[model samples]
Target: MEKKKELENLLVSVSENDDYAFRVFYDLYYRSVFRFAYYFLRNREACGEVVSNVFVAVWKSRVALRRIENIDAYLYVVARNEANRYLKESRTRRRCLSFEEIPISLIDRNSPPPQRRRSR
Candidate 1:
């Protein structure tokens, strides 16, 4: 509870655009958030991206930080959403093959064009 109160104070200062407060908040939450993301993503690169994006969002929305009721819960939600989005996008990308990605040999080059029948 004391730690939560301290974090709430820091969040208030962060909302006022205090750089030191923001730094302290980041330092305190970054590792834990990263670990949470890692457990879900299981990929170091994706976990790093998720953690970075979560902090970036917090920094960008610092002016509204005070509106957040629980910083830890907010960070966890953000990390989870980002990890799920990344995994979904990766799956979609793997399933979608671009035109250039198709092998040329697989195309039927000698296929005859269908002749249009004369209109009666």
Candidate 2:
């Protein structure tokens, strides 16, 4: 109860653009955000990126911090969104074939058209 009240006060301070309070908030919540992101993104590098994005979001939206009821849930939601975005981009990368990956035969415009099988 006391801790929750204290956190609310901290949020108010953070909302007022206090760098020290923001740093304290980040120090307290960074690990939780990182772990939540890690659960979605198993790769350390991707998780690190997600964590950085989450904190950047928090800092950018500091003015709205006081309006948030549950900071933990808010942070987790942001982390999850970032992780999902990374996963989505990775999927897109896998689906897109680079120019180098295209086979030489496919690139040969003069190649004969593939023969269609005749109906039995």
Q: On residues 15-112, what C-alpha lDDT tens digit does candidate 1 reach at each position?
A: 99899998898899889998999999888888988889898888888988898997788889988998888889999999999988875654656766
The predictions' CA RMSDs to the true structure, in order, are 8.5, 4.7
Q: Which ten residues in a row have the lowest lDDT in candidate 2?
A: 105-114
Can you give the TM-score per candidate against the true fold? 0.78, 0.80
Predicted model with the maximum TM-score: 2
lDDT of 2 by residue, 6-113 (tens): 999999999899999989998999888888888888888998898999989998999999999988889988888899999999999999999999866689888876
- Clashing residue pairs for model 1: none
TM-score between model 1 and native: 0.78
For all candidates in order, the CA lDDT equals: 0.87, 0.90
